[model samples]
Target: MNSAVTTLWEEAGFPEQTVIQRAVSDPLLAGQSVVGIAPTGSGKTLAYGIPVLTRLVPNLGPQLLIIVPAQELAIQIRDVLTPLAHRLNLGVLGLIGSANRQRQIDRLKGKPAVIVATLGRLADLIDERKLRLVDIKTVIVDEFDSFETEDITTIRHMRQDGLLAGANLGLFSATRNDDDIAAFREFWPDLQVFDEIKTDDTRGPVTHYLLDRQFEGKVQFLERLGREKHQRVFVFFNHKHIMQKVAGSLRFTHVPYSLLATDGRQVQRAEALGDFRRGRTNLLLTTDVAARGLDVADVTAVVNFELPNNITTYIHRTGRTGRMGESGTVYNMGNDHDLRDLRHLLGDSVTLVAEKPLVKKREQDDETNDENTPSTDSHDRARTRPASDKMPARKPTAAKSHNKRKQRWRNKKNVGKHW
Candidate 1:
């Protein structure tokens, strides 16, 4: 690492390199095409950023091109890399679909050293001959796991057309599967891949809980959670309609929250994110795509209003918290059947416990006794119960006690609702 960059890193309060940083720094700085996989909030950006910045020359016309899946992430990477780039007298620019194209092209006239962009907008500019990649020495594909099929196709076209022909490639993500590698190899066959390090020490300790919301509906539970003493909470929903409904309910109830939706206007989305980051909002309601790879500081808990369909989504959602070795909590809210399915999906990887209601002492001996005190939101009392992998034995409910034949008939009668 450069002495000045190291000094800047230390001045920013990062005493030492993170695990991912230590693993990828040398390979990246050597100008090798590398693929790095680590847990979310593992400082993957700096794992590549520091090295890329160290080698970049000032006054270069877009030497570094970082492709991301979403516009928000593009903006975020630009924000994170700007200060460091300026330290070396380099400039950074963001190319996103939501912003003005002419304005972006106007800014491109300044010859920025780094370009953090989404695939769609960058591809459009390249196709229109408004952007040049001649000076690009390194191209980074960040959060490749969340990219769609069209994104892959665009990347292939870029490489085939010689836009990124000679640039060294770096692929980084928190999750990976067979398909991801197969797709990468199909395009960049010579790239060296690094297997995910199981013993990742960067992710902090996270306590998982299955909070029962049978009596209290999921939205009601979120409302109550916002009223508690929690700092920053991320509430995820699988369905957009459900998330919007919850957001409306939170607003009606005066619970502070910010919504991050794919269809929101750029300025509005930026404002919402800024409000959340500044602690003006207690809760951020979003889906998986909108929140992926977003790093916010001091997030206390992650609440799943509706459990995700797969374990990969679960990992990314919970990853918003417990980042960079910070203690955090994850609450999976659902009814008995929902939680049972969630437990089955998670298997033994994550331990889930049923949160029990703890009594809150009142300043005066008031006549009203509210038993639904949320102790887990409190910093001091969040860890009142020991971590346990075993779930408590299920007590049969009246709905489950019914005969299977009748339930099958009822489900068939209400097939539309089930679907």
Candidate 2:
């Protein structure tokens, strides 16, 4: 490693290079194409970041190009590498869809040495002739599985056109299944594959608990967690509607929370993330946008407002906490059926402990008591109802029955008299 890079690492107080970082640093510095598979929060960014910076020439025009799936990820990588890049007299810039294009073009005029960009924004700039790939030496795609077929096609087209002919490629991700491995071979035949899943032990132990609750109950449960001191929680949801619903509920409660939406503007998104990181917000409500390659320190726990649809999603969500050898907890909120399915989906990869009966009894009592209290806000009342009390279907009202009879009579009269 370069002396400057090593000094910065020491200053940052990272104990040592993680397994994946050490494995790939040499190969990457040697200008070889490498695929590094490491778990989330295992220091994967710095794994390739150090090597990329060491090889960068000062005042070079975009020698390192990092392509990520989301705007937040791009901004995150840029932020993480900027300080180190500056120590070596290099500059890092982010090109994301939510930011102003004119501003990015102006920054491009500065000829930043490193660019972390989403595929779409990068492709646009390239098409407009505002950004050139000739100087790019190391092209890395973080969260490799997040790239879709179209993204791969864009990359392949660039390679075929000789835009990136001289650049070495690096693909990194948290989890890569067998099918993903097969697909990688089909796409990048010459790529070197590295699987560090079994070897990388940097992730701290994360205790998983099943919170068997329905949607409203989940919101109420979040309120309860808010009462605890020093709780920084990342709340993950499978659907945007559910996330929005929960956010609305939390707004009325005492929980200090922030909402991270995929379509939100860059500034708003950054502010939301900043709020969570700076401890202004105790809970962050988001989808998979924050699931991959996003590292926030001291995230004590992750609460799943809804169970992830797949094992990979589950892994990444739980990974939000328990990062870099820090102990964390995960609360998976769902009903009995959801809990059973989650266990089946996770299989042997993770073990889920059921929430204790005593705790459940207390929570249920709290919910019942809250519901018994009077409140003018119908929404609040609806949200605090115990999950069990919400199951029975509502009976048809008199107004609805009268309207249905009138509609039937009108239809019958019109059948014989079609004038």
Task: Report, for every candidate in turn, its global Cα lDDT versus the true structure.
Answer: 0.82, 0.83
Q: For residue 238, what is the lDDT in candidate 2?
A: 78
Model 2 misplaced stretches (Cα beyond 4 Å): 2-5, 178-188, 357-419
- How does residue 175 of candidate 2 score in lDDT? 81
Model 2 TM-score relative to the real fold? 0.83
TM, every model? 0.83, 0.83
| lDDT (tens digit, per residue) of candidate 1 on 1-419 | 66866865765467887777777777888888888888888888888888888788988689999999888899899999898888888999999999999999999999999999988799889889999998888999998878887787788777788888878888898877658667767767877777555867877889998877853477777777777775799988888998887777777666888999888999999999999899888899998888878988889899998999898899888888887778998989888899999999999989998873222446222324334443345444435555573346578877777777688897777644410
* Residue-pair clashes, model 1: 0
CA lDDT, candidate 1, residue 318: 89
For model 2, residues 1-419, the per-residue Cα lDDT tens digits are 76766876675567788889888988898898888998888888988998778888887689999999988888889988998888888989999888899999999888899999998899999999999989999989898787777777788788788898788889898888555555555545677888898998888888899887877888778887765779899888878988887776766554578888897877888899998889887888888965456788899999988888888788777877887788989998889999999999998889788864224677798888889966558566666898677655589999999999999998776653311
